[model samples]
Target: MSGSGLSSLAAAMESAVQDAPGVRVQTDVLIRAATAIDHSGPGSPDWRARVAGAIEELVAAGLVECPRTKAGWDRRTLPELPHWVRRSAPPVAAPRMTAKPWHHLLHWVPTVDSERRLSSAERGLLDAVNRWLPAADQVPVVPMRERSWGLLGDDKALEKLRSGRLFVPGRLTLELLRCRSTWPPVQQRVLGAGTWLIVENWSTFESLCTAAEADGFDGRIIFGSGNQVGTRLAALADKGDTPASPVLYFGDIDVGGIRAARLAVTTAQGAGWPAIRPCRPLYELALASPHRLRVQPASADTVSWTTAWIAGELGQQVAMCLTRGEAVRQEAVGLEILGPAPFAALVADV
Candidate 1:
């Protein structure tokens, strides 16, 4: 009612205590809260002046001891706790992690002594290192090699790459970009290249690239596996104000792939590039004949089950084959649809 009777310090201190990692009851926090309460609250305007007089009149002083625990940062307690601003939270419990250790969320590190700012590279490297550790309630420092200006930390940049960037120690360039291990840095194109094709999965991209080369259609190939297709769309579409080039997307025939293709076209169009419609002959390939469908195991947590379930106990696998219309894994068969090289020179057109 009356300002929650809480001065800024007491209210904030209690909150920090609840959110702190592992556990905490820092004695310093208590001292500060007590001091603030005595000096500023209730009948104490010139409270500091009255402190010396009140101390002489106080009783049972030495009996109270600060609380201590092994759970978190140093906290203070007493034999008989005071009205204890009674933090609206409960005590933190340690994790009983097994092979998969359950770690806290924050990974906090105290700033009392080592007050320093983290470099971009250093922060990236720390995040990379943390992947090896458990969760924490506090933020911790991780060591890494020189950071990269090339490795921008914005969400948009990472989205474009479809991978998380992290700093690593003993590295020459900035941190490494994450991607499917099979993926290679897009380099020069091959000779028998056919028309350019962009796909959402690397395995599929590889299969198609190889398949096209086999047929003497050497052209540029790209993996748009991570959904966010900013760069590929740029190459296919013109820059803002320029004409967009034609680019074809080859993805699954299912609704998800359709969504991804639609997004690519829209993004390209918005950027003033020529937004090409994606082509997945594979969808037609599967639907042209129902017998070719292949069934796969179902996991309840995924959407694969919703559209794929068939009748009988064999429903999961059977439905999977029909709903999406076959695995058609990139490795399974993308070359036949891609055909031979005819458009190999586009990569150099600029």
Candidate 2:
């Protein structure tokens, strides 16, 4: 291997070790990660030989240590590298609420077929719900509209499937507090409690619903559905059935999240619902979470309105996330943190 190529391999190994001190990775993984930035194209047999030689150089330089496994060349271990600071430990896998209790809510969520397995995003949504629904629940639902189907970007035909009568049975519906829905009665009470929990992502929404119900939360829950939250929030605000209830929104810690929450509140205000705001407790937990991912930094407009609702330090964290392009996903908060007991304590005043 050339000196520069060896140096580049060493840097990638160092990064992997720093990202996860004791993790194991396949040779392909290391090769792919290295070549991603190198743009030299994944090498062939001669290239593979060069990679192996580079690994030996790293070992010789005392910068990386790899132990052979039964998997042979397929896998290697990286015991923490020298002079590398370990990233924060990953959050424990949060306990997921059982699906038995929320099967009705899964009616509109799609499933895999014989030809293809669930994609990462689909699995992500189902995983949030703990994959407990019947095999029938795995069947894909036709999207009723371009907007309803936008979340599943992979289905090129989803837009074409938009129509009434034919899509009504397959359409997803949200059960609201004190408002009757034409939707099935079984799915009507996803949350029996009166709390209005507006959640961002589908997985987070499903997980929060399961967590809330498990914790005996009787409140109603709504999916923010990305930027579409304003419409949902406005609808709730316009409801005369229930007195304006305190709505607690939980979303990712990023520019989009802040903007979504702000838009929801502004939309609610326009419809005369008491101004909704961020759930501070959730924000505090997100800020301290270990599962944060980096993105492009948040802009001034993203954090401007949200700053008023968040504490000084929390606001600073939001600003920093925007500046550093970091994000704390709502999933990081876990069912235990989002359960009724903590949720109640968090919004008791509201």
Task: Say which candidate scores most in TM-score.
Answer: 2
| Stretches of model 2 off by over 4 angstroms after superposition | 1-193, 237-243, 336-343, 346-350
- lDDT score for candidate 2 against the true structure: 0.53
TM-scores of all predicted structures: 0.32, 0.44
The true-structure Cα RMSD of candidate 2 reads 20.0
What is the per-residue lDDT of model 1 for residues 1-350, given as tens digits with 9 covering 90 to 100? 02544444444444445544534344445545546645543354323222211211111122112223224212131111222222223324432212322223213321211344443434443444345334322423321211111234343433332222221232212123322111224422344334556676776667666655665664566676546554555443322223325656656544455446656665665554544543434333333443443444222112222222111223223234434445543333345544543324312222
Span of 10 residues, lowest total lDDT, candidate 2: 176-185
TM-score of 1: 0.32
Q: Model 1, residue 221: what's the lDDT?
A: 64
Candidate 2 vs. true structure, TM-score: 0.44
